[model samples]
Target: MKKIELGELLGQMTVSEKVGQLLQLAPMFYKGTITEGEITGPMAEMGITTEVSENAGSVLGSTTASEMIAIQEAYLKTNRLGIPLIFMADVVHGYKTIFPIPLAIGATWDVELAEKMAAISAKEATAAGLQVTFSPMVDLVRDPRWGRVMESTGEDPHLNSAMAASFVRGYQGNPDELAENHEKMAACVKHFAAYGAAEAGREYNTVDMSMRELYQNYLPAYTAALEAGSKLVMTAFNVVDGVPATGNEWLMRDVLRDELGFDGVLISDWGAVKEIINHGTAANSVEAADVALRAGVDIEMMTTCYLENLERLIADGALPVGLLDEAVMRILELKRDVGLFEDPYRGLKGDVDRQQDILSVEHREVAREIAADAMVLLKNDGDLLPLGATGRKMALVGPLATTQDVLGAWSWLGDMKDAVSIEDGMKAQFDQVDVAGAMDTENVTEAEIAEMVRVAQDADVIVLALGESANRSGEANSIATIRLPETQYPMIDAIRALGKPVVTVLFNGRPLDLHGLIEASDALVEAWFPGTEAGNAVADILSGRVNPNGKLPMSFPYTTGQIPVYYNHLRTGRPADAADAQEHYVSQYIDIPNQPLFDFGFGLSYTTFAYSNLELSSDTITKMDTLTISVTVKNTGTIAGKEIVALYVQDIVGKVSRPCKELKRFTKIDLAPGEAVVVTFNLTEEDLRYYKPNLDFTSDPGDFNVFIGTHLQAAFCLA
Candidate 1:
């Protein structure tokens, strides 16, 4: 049936029947074990014609296919209306074959590989009885201190938008695939509004920003996801302009539904609808339901706010009956689109052959390939990498050298036993390698430091793996000081004193203050939690099988005081000049430099690449014209390597102040000895536009500067 025709049918249903569409309850069973009564009893009593089981609504931690199928079978057989439930899970990164975190994937700057990774994740999730994935979190997070930043694409809007579109396409492919096994699951582009720019980088904190900043800096990724055919959007936990996001009609209805033309179902984040009472925006559960339903939130996840109060709110004249009918129609249309109306068990099947595809060997290989590309080479002074295995005696030491902390953070449903440690990879490479455990499981000691020094005395090279534990940097894991633990610093200083060419491998979720380590080590690799295959991928780069082409997606700060530093920040009107700057007055600090430890797009290669003069197709253009900016890149060093040529643009005389440089385009190219290539980036008027005070997106014709290089200061131009 047509969607509008389905809306008319839902409008004829009673008020109690309309409230059933909003309720999503958890199931109480495992396999054939019946822990609680049938799902139909309570649902029938409340006049709920459409009810969702726990296994159908959202999967907690991890669940088996057999258990999920049993629950769905029971729901279908007992429910009066037989409205099939939609299954959802947090399949971020990977489902069973774990890959690197999202931030690490952004560092690779390879959209093709990221798209393939999501496709593999979708296949595995569908095999595990899931119809939806709450993934491709495209929020642009500038604060590394935020625990959820590890789940985002990175700090740039343009990069996030491109990656988001690729993920949506990969998850929901062409029409033929959608017909094959109900094709693919729905892709949920999450945190509907500004949830990343929280106060002090704290999770679920209040957000305060002008509308201009919201549209230009943060809203682009969500908009891109909608255009890519996303079926659902999850609301954030924070408030915008003193109104909670779960209850904000302007964001959910006016902006998303009216302005952007997004017709997807809006779901609350976890229990955000019930959380509005804690935000002091609602008096009780009934008021929370009244606010959320009016704001156009169609699904209430895990919270009983909607199930218990929506009917009362409608009867009391707080919520109109037409709104409830509209929400039920959208929900029913999604059910039919997924083919659940034809076959109730479309997503869940107990067939052993289908369950075997969840974590196949082919999926694991793709996980390893993506983890290797995500590794960013932070510093390599004197080209100290590509360790030779013929005659070198290497010493691998540190707390996390052989531990499971390499799995990174937000490894939901990921098995730690399958992860590879750095020590395992290094030992596999060479025959004469010595492994030494220098610290206790929980803390480091002085005796451990002495043992590390003694072990490195006879070795030709030292590989030190150091970073936080898995629990130290995730949610509720914020710290006042973002530095290496005091205990580990002694071990690092002791190993550096041995003078045996030290190479530091860092495993972290966010950027750390690495000033002391940079000065002590000959080389550094920022391997941000390369998931299941972390050890093997790091070994490949260390043994010269693959070159490190990954760049920093987030800035590495020199100190903790530069907590919120980024590359595209606006310049002040009276920027301090070094000649007249003093510690007492200007934006200068008394003790530290006002620069990052490593800038964005900063990474070293085994070989070097140089940029030549830039040429533009034309010097002047109108709003409808296009410009082609080209630059020549040549390999200057002996070793063959890959280089990421970046293009940045600046609007010099805008009505509002802009950033010093914004990344417009970038390309990664592989080069051989003495090889060169001409990289071209096309510019459109849309790339030059920014949101004004009134949310107008247009660029005024003026002199614009184009920058092309490996770093930000490579070349300059006027167009």
Candidate 2:
């Protein structure tokens, strides 16, 4: 049927039926029966006779395959309208065979590998009776204290856009295959607007950036996801400007729907619509329903506010019937797209071992390759990396060295039993290494510290694996200070004091304050939650099988006071000129340096690379033309390695101020010993465009500086 025809059919329905389409309740599952008591009982008690199926407009969590099938079957058998329920799960990384978090995957910069990971996740989730995943959270975050940064792609908008498109394509695949047997599930892009720019890096707080900053810094990923055919968009819990995002019509209607042409169902984050009452924006459930419905939020996730008062609002003339039909039609269109209207039992099978063939050996091999690629080498002074297997008595010490903390965060269904720790990975190579936990097995003690120090004295080199736990840096896990916990500091000090060479393998979800550790360790490797095969991948890099080419996705701060520091910040007029200045009126702190512990796009390898003079295609160009910037990168050291040639752009003069540097493009290339290659980046008007005060995007014709460098400061921009 045509979508407008479906809208007309929905428009003729009663108020209760239209509200029922917007209410997505949680299903109550039992041993053998899935009844409507939890949802339908409330409906009947509230005098709301018109309702969908028992499982329609609901989310199911943590159910076995058989149980899911039984519940779905009962829903189909008992419902009057026979609308198939949309089964959604938090398939953040992997469904069952878990991978690393999205930030770690972004470090790989391999779009093909990321897409393969999402495809495998979809296969596993589909086998377990899931029809949708709340995944590919594309919010661009620069602050490390925000706990949800672990779930995003990274700070760069372009890279986040690329990864977002790749993930959607992987999850949805071809529409033809999805038309057959519900071939693919829907990918939901989340936190609809600017949840990442929360004040002080707190989660679910107020976001108060200008509209220009919002459009330029945060909206690219959402736009890319829409273009990639994502069928659902989830609203954030934070308040933008002074209004809660769940109730902001300007964001949902003007920005997302009218501007971006997103016609998909707009779903709210868990209980966010109701929580707006606490945000001081809504007076009651009725008011909340009125606000959200008018703002274009079609689906109420886990919140019965819409079902409770949506009918009353429509009757009281606060909401129009046409708005309700618009929402219902969008929901029904998704149902039709998933083939649910055609075959109600399409994804309701309990026995899906046949579909388990999707998780093949090729998938596991790809996971290993991506995990190896995500590992960033932060510091490798004097060639301490690629440790030879012969005559190396290595001492591996730290609490996380042998633990399963490398799974990272939001690995909802990752098998902890199968995860390999750092000690296990290092043991496969050397036989003489002594493994000692830095802290107490149950609780940290002095004796454990003494043992770690004693073991460090005997070995030729010490390998310290230090990082945060998988649970310390995800949702509801925000930290006020991004420093190392006091418990791990003693072990680090003791190991560094042993006077032997120390290599620190840092495993973390967000960027950490590592000034002391950076100065103490001879070499540093950032293995940010390499998944189940983390150990094997680390062993491969440390043993010279795979070269370390991963670069920092987020800046590592020297102190927690510099919480939101990033490389693309603008230069103020009164910026500090002297590094030794004791006072400044600009954005400078009194005690701490403004520089980061490690800059973004900064990573080291076993070999050295040198960047020579940069050359451009022409000094001037017309408005319709493009420019090519070229630079030569040579491997100056003995061993072969790979380097990421980064290109940034700076607008010297504009109607409004601009960032000091913006990442335009980058390419990762492999080089043999003493080999050199010239890489080029083509830039058009799109790369130079900026949103004006009137919200128009245009590039002013002026002299722009193009920078080609390994790091941000070590670059010469051509005028």
Candidate 3:
């Protein structure tokens, strides 16, 4: 269909039909789907009608191709224009063949691998008949206390931007090609404008920050995702400045649409429009609907505010009909773009072969590969890892040893029974493997600890699978203290007392306070949530089948006291010296050291790497000249491994205080034993640009120090 046809369709829609096009509800509200049921209480409460339900532009949460087909097929019978309903869901990480969580994908530091994982997720999700995924949540998170940090890539804007673009490309292919492509689904970059910086790291708390800070830190990744051609943006539940994002005109219109040039669908985050009343921004549902529509929100999700009040608002001359026409046109264009106007089901007509498409062998292999690459080796004391499978009797003991809740949150379509446990993967690799532990982390008993110790006594090495359960992190799951449950400490202490070398594998979603666990374990693996291939990936790393190459995307704090520890932070006047702890009047904690337990970009390999011969092409350069940096990395240990070389820049002088070190570029390279290779990076003037105090984004001409992997430094001047 042509653009003029969309205009014609918009012109044909009545006031009620246009309002219905701006509303998105759940599939259960409609009939003929798998979850066809009555919600009389909710229906009466939200004032929903059969007419509005049949004419809703989209559905939020429905699984399976048959459900989508049934919903669309049944709905078209009632509508005069026969518009198709688009199905969207929170397919955050994966659909059926689950990969590692978004945070784990960031730890891989491989943008290509991240893109591959997302492509596989799109393949699986589209096979199940999903049309849009609320994914690649590009929120820059510095606080691990925020449970939604698992949804974000990390603290750095640059890394998150790179991952965001990669995810968009994987999900939608090219924006121009998304219209005709049936294998991929549309991508929605969510929680727009600093939802991650909620005060106190609490979920849905107030997000108060200066506009300059917002632009400098929180807004870049969202801009990058939009630039990469994401088709939709989700409004955040929190407030931007003093106004809720769902009803903030300056944020939605002046910033997102006008400045960022995003003209796509803007949907509210699960009744965020109605909740604006709770934020004291609106007096009632009527006011909320009027405000949200004027603020440029295209869809009111999970609420009937638009269905209930949009027509009245327009009749009272409060809202122009042109706004409704514009919104309806966008929805129609999206429908036409996704080929829904032509084929409402979008190739989901026939019975989908689950075995051949959903969790096929190819998909599982990609999941396993990504899961292994995403596991970061946080610690390895005296080379205790890579246990020899032939001679050693390995005992897998912990709450997560045999449980299949390895696929973490937002995996709506993933079944726990299909997930591989640590015990299952270990037994496949080793003939002598024993497992004994509690099945639940919070419900562990003394008897379970005693049994775990008994199993550890007979084994040469212990592979302790521990960490937060699948529910401990994700949206609305924030905790005050980012520590392991107290109940599990006894299990850790008991196994450590056995004097067996313990290689601890953590299945968590956020950075944790690892003070006690670090002391009790010989080796530590930060396996965030490896999805369906959890056990096999852990086994590969433990048995020397795959080397651990993942790095820390977020810093591990010493304790919860240091809640928001990150590498790139503004310089202070009086900096604390780690050499002198007694010094006062500095930014240092009295009880604990200021440094993080494990810094960002910190990871280990079974084989070690040595950096040498740092050189720069020139000491000075103009704005137009590109500076070349070179460093040689050697695999010092006697094994093949991948090394991540990180490059950071420190601006000596700027208009405002700048971060002491900021990551500019990084690369992952494979090296064999005793092999060396020169890694080079071209640094242009664009790399040094930052927002000034007056909000002007430009690079400064000053002295800069380039550090390679936190050690080798070379001084240069940007002239």
Q: How many backbone clashes does every candidate have?
A: 3, 0, 0
Q: Write the per-residue lDDT of candidate 2 for residues 250-349, one digit (tens) a residue.
A: 9899989999999999999998999989999999988888899899999988767887787787788878878888898898888777776666556545
**TM-score of every model versus the real structure:** 0.93, 0.92, 0.98
Runs of candidate 3 exceeding 4 Å displacement: 34-41, 350-355, 578-582
Q: Mind sharing the TM-score for model 1?
A: 0.93
lDDT of 3 by residue, 659-700 (tens): 989988999999999999999999999999999888889999
Rank list by TM-score: 3, 1, 2
Error of 2 at 623 (Å): 1.9
The lDDT of model 2 is: 0.79
Task: Select the stronger candidate by TM-score from 1 and 3.
Answer: 3
Ranking by lDDT: 3, 2, 1
**TM-score, predicted candidate 2 vs. hidden true structure:** 0.92
- Per-candidate Cα lDDT values, in order, are 0.77, 0.79, 0.89
